[model samples]
Target: MEKELETTVCEERIFESLYRKLSKSIHDFLYYKYGSNCNPNDTTQEAFLKLWKNCDTVSPAKAKSFLFTVANNMVLNHLKHEKVKLNYQKATTKTHTNVSPEFIMQEAEFLEKYNAVLANMKEEYRVAFLLSKAENKKHKEIAELLDVTVKVVEYRVHKAFTILKEQLEGFSIK
Candidate 1:
């Protein structure tokens, strides 16, 4: 007798089957891509949760790619956020006990303006800009990371810089 195929993840058996089929593969993918230090197991669980949550829109046939893309993007987002946090930590940890209060205030205000400008910019441009300036990554590296061409990265970085310059005309970090 043929078992009924599942059209949605609402079926317990089908969901279990998918878990059995995909869980190890997804775990392995995250492990190899981000290393186990990233907690591939946790990311895998999150990916599965997302799959369950979006099952209505994602057919079983498309679930594999969906899971992989979501997991990869989640890792990228985590990495980007960590990078920003680390940079901010490094910047703030530097001692400036000899600096005047006015200079410190100006620096803080400039940083606020810079963050606001980045937030208002297109995501692509902001990402390229941060990778270039914050991480000191080359355009080619940014292109590889973003899966875009070098020219595209260059354009985004340039646009980001132009926006920063225009918006922060009166402000200087130092």
Candidate 2:
């Protein structure tokens, strides 16, 4: 029991020494990589915690490199996850404007004509068309956000406009 206690004390001393020597550099590197979103202090604290957890595998000489790699990867993964969540929110928002009854009636009439036109379209073309026209997204931006090709976006938009123009030829402007 006494020998085990001494070994634990020695390990703690090694961790403390390594942290004092390398914490500042690790924090600076993370700050440069992640900018404002990654707090230096938080990353430094997390590094020390991780170092403590994996102390057996990390020697004092290599501790800073290990911490920097882990911190950088964590920040990148966080950013990627946030982008996906934001895109989902934007895609689900209602695109049509809402106002009083007069505007509502006009919108309903347009929707009826729009639906009839859309009903004949292939699913992919219909989705691209509605997302572009209703949401006002640019072709390239829509392509990137939807993971489709820009050419596909262009084709769908053109097809949808052709169908709408044909369907609404006799409809009066409200």
Candidate 3:
């Protein structure tokens, strides 16, 4: 008897290929949608794990779509858990430094203001800003990652710079 043609993602080779091709995109999607607060890296891994767990049901052709949907839902569900967002934001804002107490206090105050301003900034501006500056992505790359025109990416980044400059008047990022 001849073996049946494999259609599902049960084959390790197929699964690996899908992973190599789609993982980065999925991670980027989650990051653009939720920022560091949602921990997009973890979310992407979980989405792939779900796909692997359901490999017998998910076809190779639909695997990409499945991963994206799973990741998006995972982040949304996580965001819905209220305290999780606050916890992540707080955790990220906290800092550990070996400087003098006065400097430490100043750093904490700056961190608090920075986090607060970021939290209040428009989501589009913040996302673009972080990706461009924190992540060190060029405008064209960010445009591609964000699925927008280069001009739009430039505009959003400019708006983000304006917000940061106004909000962090005395605090310079060196």
Candidate 4:
């Protein structure tokens, strides 16, 4: 008589197989979504652990979806928490730099002039400039957020800088 093969996939086998197959993809997903703010390795590990915990209910065919879903949710939660923390810090923090009265006054005047120039710039130019400079968003990201093209974002930002430079010709920050 011919012997039969064992076709049942147990939890341990699933963990080993899935870890090798899916861990890098999951890590790359988290890294691309969250950038450097989140630890993709840690998030990937947590996702795998959760998958192993619920392995009995999950099949190898469905494991990829399950892992991705878990990882995505965890990253979203982490980003939300980080936003809250950052908002709290911004609300409560104050700069305490020591400087002479003359330097402080010069700095304030420069800032006031800069703000006036920025405020007078075209709305689109100002928005692009601020998103690029203040928010540190990439041109591609700003373009996507504003529903414009990358070339448009680059042009607006450049125009804004040129306008500001001309408007603040005599002003210098100390």
Give the top-scoring candidate (TM-score): 1
Itemize residue pairs with steric clashes in candidate 2.
none
Worst 10 residues of 1 by lDDT: 1-10
Tens-digit lDDT string for candidate 3 (1-174):
123344568888888889899999998888887898899889999999999999998877788999999999998898788677777777765466667999879979988989899899999999998998898999999998989999999999888788888889585554
List candidate 2 stretches off by more than 4 Å: 1-10, 94-174
Error of 3 at 120 (Å): 66
Per-candidate count of clashing residue pairs (backbone under 3 Å)? 0, 0, 0, 0
For each candidate, what TM-score against the reference? 0.51, 0.46, 0.45, 0.46
Per-residue lDDT of model 1, residues 4-106, tens digit only: 3446775667678888999999899989989976788888899989988887888777788998998888888988998999898788565558889999998
- The candidate that wins on lDDT is 3
What tens-digit string does per-residue lDDT give for candidate 2 at 105-163?
98788888778778877777788887887788899998997898999899988877776
Off by over 4 Å in 1: 1-6, 97-174
- Which should have the higher TM-score, number 2 or number 4? 4
1-174 per-residue lDDT for model 4 (tens digits): 121123212557657878999999999988998886789999999998888778767767778999999999999999899899989888955667578889999989988989999888889999999999888999999999999999999999988888887888674322
Go through the candidates in order and give each one's C-alpha lDDT: 0.85, 0.76, 0.87, 0.85
- Go through the candidates in order and give the C-alpha RMSD of each one to the true structure: 20.1, 14.8, 21.7, 16.8
lDDT preference between candidates 1 and 2, better one: 1
Q: Indicate the TM-score of model 4.
A: 0.46
